[model samples]
Target chain A: MQPPVLELVDLKKNIKNKEIIRGINLTLGPAEILGFLGPNGAGKTTTIRMIVGLIRPTAGSVKICGYSIADDFIRAMSNVGCIIESPEMYKFLSGMENLRQLSNMDKRITRQRVDEVVELVGLQKRIEDKVSTYSLGMRQRLGIAQALLCRPKLLILDEPVNGLDPAGITEFRNLIRRLAHEEEMAIFVSSHLLSEAQLMCDQVAIIRQGSIVKTATVKDILNTETVEWRLDNPVKAARLLKEKWGIEALRENGNTITAAVGENRLELINQVFVNEGIELRYSIPRQNTLEDMFLDLTEGDEIA
Target chain B: MLRLIENEVFKIIFKKRLLIVFGILLVLITAFAYGQDNSLNRTKARLAGRIGITASTDWKKLCEQQIIDLKNRLESPYGHEEDKPATRVRIEQLQYYLENNINPLDSSAAKFTTQFMEQSIFLFLPLLIIILAGDIVSGEAANGTIKLILTRNIPRWKVLLSKLAALLMLEIIVLLMAAVISAAVSGVFFGYGGWTAPVATGFRVIGDRLETLGVVNVPQWQYALMVYGLAYFVSIVVGTVSFMISVLVKSTSASIGVMMSALIGGNFLSHFMSDWKITRYLFMVNLRLTDYLAGSFQPVAGINMAFSVTVLSVWAVAALAISFVYFMRQDILV
Candidate 1:
């Protein structure tokens, strides 16, 4: 229904004959959060960099808000907000002053917009403090505040919650969710923490060895592989599931049965195992988690 | 571009370091003027005392008597004017006055008083330039602000142009401060209205047969302006070169060290290159813009105003080109 806010088509990046990002294709749509998941050297940062125009792609092209990154750099960049690596800022300046100066780069971002974004990032109380005195979490919040100044259509943050403490991480997660939910911004965030991605993102693209191994909705990815289910009786459920419901399944050990589950299989199996005469200690359907899925996808290739 | 240049110019002119440099120059210029003024006053007083005695105040007759007294006392060669050029010239010129009534020292008192202002413009202003121009860009790079500036998505050319504008503004400010301090201090000591003052230098080499231009009498104000302008230009060229080296080198110390070495080395090499036949192209030779004030030939024999202008212009352009090319393409890993 809505045009993609940010799109990368078969992008490749090479440096000194070493390929960093090998053909990554991704699309971010309105009010969608795409979790870009990968290991440390799996081209996660490089792909995000190309999207934000920090570096040029060796091949393919990137488009932000329907504008080509190469042909219309200013316009494309105008629609995208990005935080690359750690928050690099002028430490000598106050957070508010830093935001004010960066906001001046684009003519459209006014003083009111800077104030609004500062408040949105929950840095209103400490905006006047110099960045040199900010803790890692506070700096991260300021970085996000700077990115949101123009209310960009697309926001790219690489490991946005990397250095946040537990409470800070909770606050950042809620703030990102609110920005996407209320502001209707397409959010593309990359992180190595699969649990963080699962809790934050609606859609995701998993990268391994500079290639996108899997991309889908969170439910679809969690459904891709079967999870090993542990039970009190084990082999009885696999035999019963296969024989009774014509389901494909596998038995791991005396107390565990592994089966690929569909969307409503959890409810169906709980009913089915209760209806049967087996002593149902636990009848939960086994579905692959994001962590397991990430490992399965990236396990075959060299990380760097 | 103008806005960027304005911001940069404001930063340079308002920087505390530049203010400190101006303050140092002001102190040195004031001290030199005060010191020179005291010596001039003492000389004037001694000459006045020689001329003020009664019975026509015959200073030469009295000096001769004093010399005879000294000769009788110490067996020294006294009152002989034939050996040393300066003393011989002074004694011979005073001989007529010794026969008449004019005191020899009072004859040149007006000339000495007039030339002191010109000497300030020539000598102290160049030192002021050296202090500011030596560290223009190196200071920014040393503070790690260059990368922060470059990442603003402002074009690389704009960044360099801004820096050049800043350096140019500081150079002008320093030059103006020197000029004002010189004018004010000289006015305080020598009492202003002698602006048509004459200046003299010891060695004026007259060239052969090209319309023999005699002693050039530049008004004291014009001489000050010319010396300040030329000194400012020389300082700006050095500042631009130092900026280029700052962009090229990794460390600020190295940038300052290299440019200062090149500056000192250029002057040192120019001394030997007088016989080298190609010393005219060296930027250091044109540094003595005051030589033109004395109605003499330019520094490197045949390199006139047009040649000095061309060489200095070329150096400035080349330095700017190298700075832009290197800075735009540098990988800002910092």
Candidate 2:
């Protein structure tokens, strides 16, 4: 009976007569992680900007903790923490000082909480050094520390791991999962790294050209079965599968055919190919990855 | 809001902007004090060469001689009609100094403090204020830290208001630095002994005539306070205008450039177009607010202290309104 931690209803935006975001609606509950995936110029950043109050929406509402962003901005924003783009801090100040500056803005934050977040992000080693001297990975950690200062109920991260190493990325994924599951916080993350998202996200929403084209659970997306056929004369094999067995197979390459048939059908499919005039090399069942689903949904647009 | 202002003040302090302003004041004040001492010694030497040993003790003779020369120039009929009133005022000032037994050439730290502010109000003081206030808002935008602040739980107007308050506080500090540095530096050269000296003020020019009814003599310290007060007013006006420009422009260097050009261009416009009636209404033309207290000559015809203050107040208010409205409604695309 509790309201969702973050909600967007009929969100829209227009810039100089060009529609940038067209009626985006989403809801995130407690302990949920939604990966917002989109190609370049697809309104991903624009949508994040609107949620953080950086850009005004043409028509719609962003509500946080049951408070409308437009009418109760301070209250709504108090419940949310975000990094819209790159995590930029005051370079002249030490990392600890930057955290102190942000902590001062909210009344609920305390000195103990600051140190806790610093330890949480593993920035305690170099926290007292000037941010200008900190590496990109360190700055990213400090930014996450700043966002966690007020114990926000909803966290929004845009390309949070763009500059991180593989180990850092894995560590960040674990931290995000822990935050969501243990703290019961709703997190919305926009990322171009689909493999990372596949490991970190519970659900994925792929957007294209200012509209949500697909939204599904990661488990559902990865659970969809398919059989790939590696054989001679893929064109003839595809036609034969469609005509004889009423199956639609996609010609992925010159000599390979993929169909949404279960793994049990692979043996029969191989037999069909052998009985026919086609020379069968092999047949294997494969699970769709988030990358594969993302490419299929976006039609290979440039992912930024 | 207090925390916000504290944040702003610390940011400016860490940026070393106030230190730069203080450094500039120290260097310029020292140079001007040295120049003044040299000029005063040169005048003393010239007077000693013309007269005998009595030149140092007898200032009345020099005053009378200068008055006589001015009177002769007034009667020669070779002077421009428009310049006659200023000459007559200078002659009257000399005669009044003689009557009051006050030597016009007796320089002191108090006198230097007042004089320095009067000379710097129109250009130097305003430039220092611009350096302090020009990037309060735009610097954050340029460096990408504006998003960090704007994404916090504070309202947009509160953020801007805190910045303005911090700027005003720093402007006061700048004026204080100018006064203290000028007085301190000049005292070492001028002997620091004129705080109780009498100074004449409240002179008015009404239609090509010197109006002396309002003239009164106050102590040199009181006179310095009035001059610095006027300078502070001018500083606030300049600071507010530049703060507004900071909001309108996102790049710090561009904001500073725009304000600098407008200020310098206004100075030139006031000189080249003094005859234009609209020129008197410009805030830049009225920046020399201390001139009214010192009873200096006016280049343009109809502006008085009340008129200048009104013009400046209008400009400051308009700029503040524009800044708040625009900032509140802006998308902050950067």
Candidate 3:
């Protein structure tokens, strides 16, 4: 069996004696997209930097394809391609020239590979133009193109969709999914867009205060405690359930009543309503979402 | 490593307006050449008129007559005491030329190139070097492109070396530009000659009147080589200091400012406080090591080749060490 594509065994970083990144243990397997979800100043970028060897970790280790980042840095780095912060390149150079410069680091990438990545990112039209002329989306695409040039087994992107347009975001989302599926690459992304993460990530590790508060598969995060019910007279139904069953419905949006309850409570809720004179409308158990889990896990102190 | 250096060279060519330095050098050299040509032409005409009225063909008599003429000119009301040393040196030079039957006005590659280097080596060459190398490291940080470089899996020291190598390459180009421009512009006006002719140098000031001690007759081109060679050396030392500052300072403009003040103030301090023994140890004060070649007079004695080289070397190593140590261990906050 192949080893996991990435392994972080309790990585930590301390800046000025302050723990910027506490112990963060994470593992990403082949073809899995792991979202590093965190609020501002939660050390997402710092952790990524440590993994790429841009900065040394104060404690623990990062293993890429079973190679320790601290002991076998170059080999570990050879397996990883990342942008720990905003995508940046020499603005005076053309997109193609930027790729060519990066290609010097790894001999495996050639002109053919550069052209392929550029075409894949849809930057062939502007590949020859200086990056100074590129729009935010174009630069982001070129950033991805550069990361993809060497065919890294583990790809990390930090806030990749921050500046993209709506159409560009959708296109990039599809491209990332395709890269994971087609190349069998283990991809890691750090973002605050919970909705975007819900759609794009296979697993998520929510970080708060420099520590991993929770880590779970996206499907499990969506299998949360908060459930929504579709019933006739949601307002009256909410009051009736609160008064009769002492079960508080948290919110009522239109004909839907939402409450913090487990999936097993739906049958009991319907039984109680059926015993009353209120006619039972069709019950729709709204799926739990990552957003609900993110807020719940973070204590709702705004994800900046 | 070769590829890293090549990448740095590429960035130097494209990321900054290096051509601006080249262009400014071209314009300044051409303008200086134009002015020198007009003055040289007028002096040539005057010398020819003087030669026309001479009655004797004896070289000794001509020298005597020219000496008297120079004396009378010095005594004239228009001549000032401040101009005495320069005027006296010109007279001494003329006497040597006449005694040897060489026409000083005859434009030769040696004469023009010598004059060109003397005018360039002091402040002009260093100014241009400062402009080109001022942003070597700091500019990368300011542009946010340092992330691209540092993330390349290459070691940090190797990356710094690449930048230093690129700066050295840039220094060579600037020196070459100066040489080629001066040679070309002065060649056009002076009809370049005397490249192989012997030129006398190694003069030292004594008392008030002009005196030449241990005059070495080297080929004109050989003399030009030594002059440009020393200028290039000084520029590198200064450029290295600038690079060191560039690494430490994050703001490109601030880096340039810090180095410029050191350079200008070095010269300023040397001029005002040459008596202070402490000033002799400053790199900027000792940067004029070429002055030792011409045996130029200094208010102090410690500014020599050995002193300058030692100071510059120490500063270079210290700065590079500080740069590597600080950057390697410190956080890249940006």
lDDT values of the candidates? 0.67, 0.89, 0.78
Model 3 Cα lDDT, one tens digit per residue, B223-321: 888888887887777788888888888888998899878888888988778678898878877776666665555545445567677887887778778
After superposing candidate 2, which stretches have Cα over 4 Å from the reference?
A230-247, A252-255, A262-281, A300-304, B51-56, B69-85
Q: After superposition, how far is residue B298 of candidate 1 from its true place, in Å?
A: 7.2
Q: A25-99 in candidate 1: lDDT tens per residue? A: 888888999999988789887787677655668899998878887677667777777787777766666898778
- Where model 1 places Cα greater than 4 Å from the true spot, the runs are A1-3, A52-54, A125-129, A206-209, A222-225, A229-289, A296-304, B6-15, B23-156, B181-215, B246-258, B271-302, B325-333
What is the C-alpha lDDT profile of model 1 across B200-306, one tens digit per residue? 32223333212213434444455556666667776776677667787787665677677666666767666656657766676665666555454344334565656
Candidate 1, after superposition: displacement of residue A192 in Å?
4.0
Ranking by lDDT: 2, 3, 1
Q: Which candidate is the best by DockQ?
A: 2
TM-score attained by chain A of model 3: 0.85
Residue A160 shift from truth in candidate 3, angstroms:
0.9
Candidates 1 and 3, the one with greater DockQ: 3
TM-score of chain B of each: 0.69, 0.95, 0.83
Clash pairs detected, candidate 3: B108-B193, B109-B193
Model 1 chain A weakest 10-residue run by lDDT: A277-286
Which residue pairs collide, candidate 1? Answer: none
Q: What DockQ would you assign to candidate 1? A: 0.16
